[model samples]
Target: MERGDFTDLPGLGKPLEDLGPAEQGHDPDWWLKRLVEREKITVLPPALQLRRDDAALDDHLDRLGGEAEVRRELTEFNDRVRRVLYSTHGGPPVTTPPRDVEEEVRRWRARREERRARRTAALAAREPEAPPPSRRGRWWPFGRTGAAGPSDG
Candidate 1:
């Protein structure tokens, strides 16, 4: 779907669609870092002053645990901010509708249950008891012979 379509969604609002081409090349990781930094600047509290100092921000973004931690923090902050904005603006939550797709799911579940019940009932009805073997005739591995013993021609 187009960026506008995603933005028009009830709760999605306006998510960043483009992070711009990297200076060197179209590096996804570089774009991700830029996006994360931008999101942090926009969503996080200025009063907290987490990245206020340029040196501190660079150090924090470059430490051993920096990339993963920064990405995670940015993601969480963005989600919370989005949720608050959507709720304030009367946008729907991200949850799926119970009636929309659920009706078909419920119908499928019911049909599956009914089929299982029918199969169980059919199996019970068709169950056969073991019977004793009869010794009326000599049963040979090949076709039956006219006489019980081997032919004495």
Candidate 2:
């Protein structure tokens, strides 16, 4: 049929060839999935301290060791973490602990560093002795040793 010959058709005016790429290419499911995904966008992750506080609070509660108030504190702490996670940026900080939270964070960081150092030291101590540069293994022929060979002696 001609481009404008919709008079011959009964209901629809447009011809099959006149449809756009989007209308022609994708099925209804594909369009629906795209719409659904756009509707259900994932929220951004929380700040580092926010996530860290979650774990730190967990540790503190663990150290409290099933105290009567631990459950309450855990619930409250989790709520705070969620707030920090979903809260908008450029606003005021999330927490206002009565105790020195920064001091506690420093202590946590120091403990982590010390643990890391001890682990590095242990790994170093346990490291296998590499063969001397003069010796060549099947995998590695080049070494820091001099290029001179036994024939040069």
Candidate 3:
């Protein structure tokens, strides 16, 4: 189906392709109603349902780690789905604008540098100064003080 067709389904705020193939084939209203019915059957407290859903999502994310494209697409899909579902359910919106990644990277680098500095200072504080080498009989092998040359002459 075309992307625009998804708009005909109730509470589906974005294109079908964004939600992954599994959700795209199903009607949004039908899925929402099924979810509601499941909640009713179990009579789970809303908080518990949210916790369970979050745990499932975390497990899925763990499985998807190191899959960069899948991770990015899934994150986008989750954000879109959450916004649509929460809005339809009359809850506070869970959506936020995308972050400024450059700024975030700068902050991360600064924090890393601070941590490195602290570790280096702690190591220096615990370490003792190295002792000087003994010089009584040690001689450079290539210097003019070689033992064989003058003695043989």
Candidate 4:
């Protein structure tokens, strides 16, 4: 206790930060609920999940490789959206329409090209690599091609 090992810890003496629900009055499990929300734990229905995925689909598509892969992902996403749309055992209605595979693929291609162009331009803007130092002058220090210096001449 005398060693002060616990000193300088973050928020050592400060009151705990109040999570939002405390103002609304106490639920015994508020901490648990807050934990779940903070962790982004989703128990959302298929329709809602699909909506979230729809909004971030382009970001997801950019991570995938090749047109075929992008097409496949878009098709799978569309299939899920359609399924939720048609299903009767629903929660919220599926508002996210199926993405157009061709259109998404076109966009993915354009993004890829733009990234490539940026990389190429960045490389072009950098200083040209200096030529490798010549080895010919090293071993033959007397002169290049063993030519005599003025002192020797």
Candidate scoring better on lDDT of 2 and 4: 4
TM-score leader: 4
**Candidate 2 Cα errors over 4 Å, as ranges:** 1-40, 43-101, 125-127, 135-153
Model 1, residue pairs in steric clash: none
Q: What is the lDDT of residue 57 in candidate 2?
A: 73
lDDT of 2 at 54: 57
The alpha-carbon deviation from the true structure for residue 58 of candidate 4, after best TM-score superposition, in angstroms, is 0.9
- Tens digits of lDDT, candidate 1, 12-125: 644344545445455558666777787884543432232243224324333424334655544454454444545544333333211222343344456556767999999899
- Candidate 2 lDDT over 1-153, as tens digits, reads 568776666657545432346546645476566666779954433555565565567367445533345655655665666666567776446553333444544555566567679999999899698877773443435543655554322
Candidate 3 residue lDDT tens string, 1-153: 666866677757655443446735656587666677778767544334444555454345444424454446455645655555555454444433333434534444565567679999999898687898777533664565645654322
lDDT of 1: 0.48
What clash pairs does model 2 have? none
Model 3's alpha-carbon lDDT is 0.54
> Please, what is the TM-score per model?
0.21, 0.28, 0.30, 0.60
- Candidates ranked by TM-score, best first? 4, 3, 2, 1
Worst 10 residues of 3 by lDDT: 92-101
Q: What lDDT tens digits, residue by residue, belong to model 4 across residues 19-131?
A: 44446765678788888979998688888899889999999899987888898899999889888888888488778999888888888999999999999999999999999
